[model samples]
Target: MTVLTIIADIRIKPDEVEPVLASYRNLIPQVLPEPGCLQYDLHQDNEDPAHLLFFENWESRELWLDHMKTDHLAAHQAATDDKIESLTIYEMTKL
Candidate 1:
């Protein structure tokens, strides 16, 4: 089985950073109990307060895709639409 690692590089608009950050915070407990969710943690860039990073480890790609379809994920996406300056997701596996 492949172990999937996901990195989400997120940037929030300057004026919306604080509000969008709350959205990020709200995702943690909701994700931790989900199946195949080995890890789901957030990080912030030291030099840039507007930048946020999420590191996720899942049992497989399919499980991660399932996560994307969840209501919590959709709600967060909807809430952050205007606040996000940029959103980039990278999925990887061990060589």
Candidate 2:
């Protein structure tokens, strides 16, 4: 199995940050048990509270892609729609 690591650095609108984070926090429990999902975590920048980081681990790239298409993920995306200023996604594998 391939170990996939995804890091997403997201910037949320000033006033929307807290709500966005709360939304993500609330959604994590629902997301972590999905097929192929190994881990899911959210982090906030020490200096910049508006900046958020998401760490996701999956069994494989295809499984991660499948997770992206789930209804829960879609709902999460819709909830944060347009509230994000920027988003960067990175994928990594074991050496």
Candidate 3:
């Protein structure tokens, strides 16, 4: 089976890191139990507390797409909307 890897980098506003991180922490457990989810780990950059990264592995691209449309994902976006400085997502396939 091909695993779909998603590397998401989230840069939070200088003073908003804590709240944003809290919201993301709340999101982790919800995502881990989703269908086709193999791994969904969150990490913070060593030198920058405001830099958060999500390293994810899903069974397929389609299942990941379903995850993107989940209510919890939407709630997370709403909670951290203006507090984020930049967001980047990379969708990859394990070779």
How close is every model to the real structure, measured as TM-score?
0.95, 0.93, 0.97
lDDT of 2: 0.89
Ranking by lDDT: 3, 1, 2
Error of 3 at 71 (Å): 0.5
After TM-score superposition, the amount by which residue 67's alpha carbon in candidate 3 deviates from its true location, in angstroms, is: 0.3
Task: Give candidate 1 regions above 4 Å deviation.
Answer: none
Regions of model 3 farther than 4 Å from truth: none
Q: Pick the candidate with the highest TM-score.
A: 3
lDDT of 3 at 17: 92
Ranked by TM-score from best down, the candidates are 3, 1, 2
Question: Which prediction has the highest lDDT against the true structure?
Answer: 3
Per-residue alpha-carbon lDDT of candidate 2 for residues 1-95, written as tens digits (9 for 90 to 100): 67999999899998898789888988899888888999898989899999989989999999999989988889989999889899999998768
Candidate no. 3 TM-score:
0.97
Off by over 4 Å in 2: none
Q: How would you encode candidate 3's per-residue C-alpha lDDT over 1-95 as one tens digit per residue?
A: 99999999889999999999899889999999999999999999899999988899999999999999999999999999999999999998877
Give per-residue lDDT, candidate 3, residue 44: 95
Q: Model 3 Cα displacement at 84 (Å)?
A: 0.6
